[model samples]
Target chain A: MTTTTAHMSTNAATLSTPSDREIRVERIFNAPRERVWKAMNDPALIAQWWGRGNKLVVEKHEPVRGGHWRYVEHANGEQHGFEGRYAEVTPPERVVRTFEWDGMPGHVILETATLEDLGDGRTKLVSVSLFMTTADRDGMLHSGMEGGMNESYRALDKVLASMK
Target chain B: MVHYSTSLDSSFAALADPVRRDVLVRLARRDASISDLAGAFEMTLTGMKKHVQVLEDAGLVTTEKVGRVRWCRLGPRRLEKENEWIAKYQSMLEARYDRLGEFLERTRGEHP
Candidate 1:
């Protein structure tokens, strides 16, 4: 991580409708829908990835409609906690949740994630984070989203394989 | 010194702001002069300097003088430190899964 040779791809203009605090990261996994869904639903499987390499403690995880989940990521002695309630849970298809974290008052996000089985045992995960306004979305994007998430997705690819 | 808060707190705090993160993002590609950075923002140059100072404090960027212009480049170390800290948390979960997998395998073998 200390290597510091970093470059960013500013594809902000490519987004269909750029929201102020929205963060979207799409990943195509070389696995079946069921397996992909398992990775997303199971906290054990999730702990392997999803956090971009942060050590996560699953305080609660009820991955069903109207269920709530809370977790903390510990790093460098500081703790980052996030909690949310699930709005929808259709296995191997889609899940919607309300996401809120520390420092940010109010959730400001009604997130919906769609899992599409693109045939051939491949699944595409699209996460849409809807924030209060474009400024909040832009704020998140600008605030280390590119670097943090890029590193996380890379780690997720490896975790999926190790688990399978 | 933050004896054990993890090295990423400062970096994360610095990046909590969009303006500071923008400064770091710009430095991700190449170093830019103060004016060049100020040109990219809607705020005044003084406002931009305040933003850059946050990045500087977190060790994500470094500014230097080359004649009348000040040059800034991506510090890179702060990110590496932050990544290392975040990766530790992920590693913890992965290890737990390993134990669970082993337990499941043992149970399957014993039953079947």
Candidate 2:
């Protein structure tokens, strides 16, 4: 009785329609919600998988509202640090936090990760990252690279036109 | 990084205003004099100049003095790299989730 709409995703995670100031990513993990939560909250497990392919070490992880979290990754002989503040932390359900990449300095994004039980042993995770502005979000999309901003600028024009 | 981000902040802040965005849109289509921008926006010369000043500060637009008029045009590389940084991290996040799934499976096998 899986009501999950068929997403045209070839990978485990599906990054859906991204808006001007937000990105929506969803993934279904073949584990219970509690297990999934523990895997994310536990610094030991987080260090193992948080880096994608880089070496990540968790310097601090405080899993409570108003708690602070920091982690550093070493890659190519350079250390990159990331830190955030937890806005809300509800076990096995939802967590809201602000994420900032120290590499970029002032760019910060507020993210919310929500978990839903789909019966049996499957859990669905949806995470949304909200940027401060459309340009910020667009900048992330263009991060570390170069591309024309005409499309995004047009989109920004539409957004601004609608707001007026 | 501080200087880079501050410029981006200025760019975003400049684009946040509807009038400023419209002025950008107009300039993107063609180079315009400050007077032309002011005329299109139905704003005063000083008002439009302020918007242009913000855009110039962000490096989103550039202006040059042509005789008694100032001609403004779009910046050379507009937000091209901004999307790359975000896109890179997005793939990183996706990879992390994939690894997490694998880790969870291995843990299950180990305990079960």
Candidate 3:
């Protein structure tokens, strides 16, 4: 039985688990596919947004097949490093890569990001991450929560208060 | 982060086994006696007990003795914690995507 649940809802993004070992994040951006693709691939532009307003240092970014990329985001006096290797890089369409966090070594996630043109200058970016095992996927999910728990606690408090 | 890492490591270790994961999934549907679980998984009672023990240690499952049977169910913390983790993951990505949208707006006219 598939117990897929919508954990949270936002105006522009949706996250879902399509399978036991997969995570799919889909977002609609008010921009053309090419623009969205460039922002995702260009190191300078990636640094501006990938960190979620945190100080992002793009150590190495080569958005090409077989290229390596590393980015470090500084938040709350902590440095979080992420590195990956591009497996496929078809511009304005799809990019596949392996994402690994520095904190947890050897638990790499294979991510495939596809940009779809929705017309009228809109683009849909779908990113699916496939993990080696269900446990690895669960571990990654928990780590994400633990890492951002402090920063998001106030927002969660507001949510809880509104619910009550 | 260290504490989180340690706890997550144990959780991952506990869930690494397929049988244990299946046990959690089965328990999520309804509480079952240890014998019931062993029968469903077609494993020996002692083997199933070992898997349940690992899940219990990770706080993913809870077991109790009622008369002659040891009943197992999803732990008190399991579903809530899983939902919270998923929500946190979604919100984190949403925040980043919002920033990405802003960045796209700023560089709308730039050539790729």
Candidate with top lDDT is 2
* Candidate 2 Cα outliers beyond 4 Å, as residue runs: A1-11, A133-164, B1-79, B109-112
lDDT of 2 at B23: 62
Native contacts conserved, per model:
0.00, 0.41, 0.53
lDDT, candidate 1, equals 0.61
- Identify the runs in model 1 with alpha carbons over 4 angstroms from their true place: A1-17, A133-164, B1-112
What are the per-residue Cα lDDT tens digits for candidate 1 across B11-98? 7667545456556655765789888888875557787788777777677777898999888887645455323322232232233333
* lDDT for each residue of candidate 3 in B1-112, tens digit (9 for 90 to 100): 1233355556766654545666676676699999998888677899889989887777777889999999998875484544333333344455677778778867777755
In terms of TM-score, which candidate is strongest?
Answer: 2
* Cα-based TM-score, every candidate: 0.48, 0.57, 0.55
lDDT for position A55 in model 1: 76
Comparing to the true complex, what docking class would candidate 3 get?
incorrect
Tens digits of per-residue lDDT for model 2, B4-66: 557866876765454565666566569999998888767789988998988888887888998
Of the candidates numbered 2 and 3, which has the greater TM-score value? 2
Judging by DockQ, tell me the better candidate of 1 and 2: 2
Q: How much is the lDDT of residue A121 in candidate 3?
A: 84
Model 3: DockQ vs. true structure: 0.20
Candidate achieving the largest DockQ: 3
Residue range A1-164, candidate 2, lDDT tens digits = 01112231433566653665677888888888888898888898889878766799999899899999999989989998999999999997999998888867667778899999989888899999886645665577778433446767788999999999
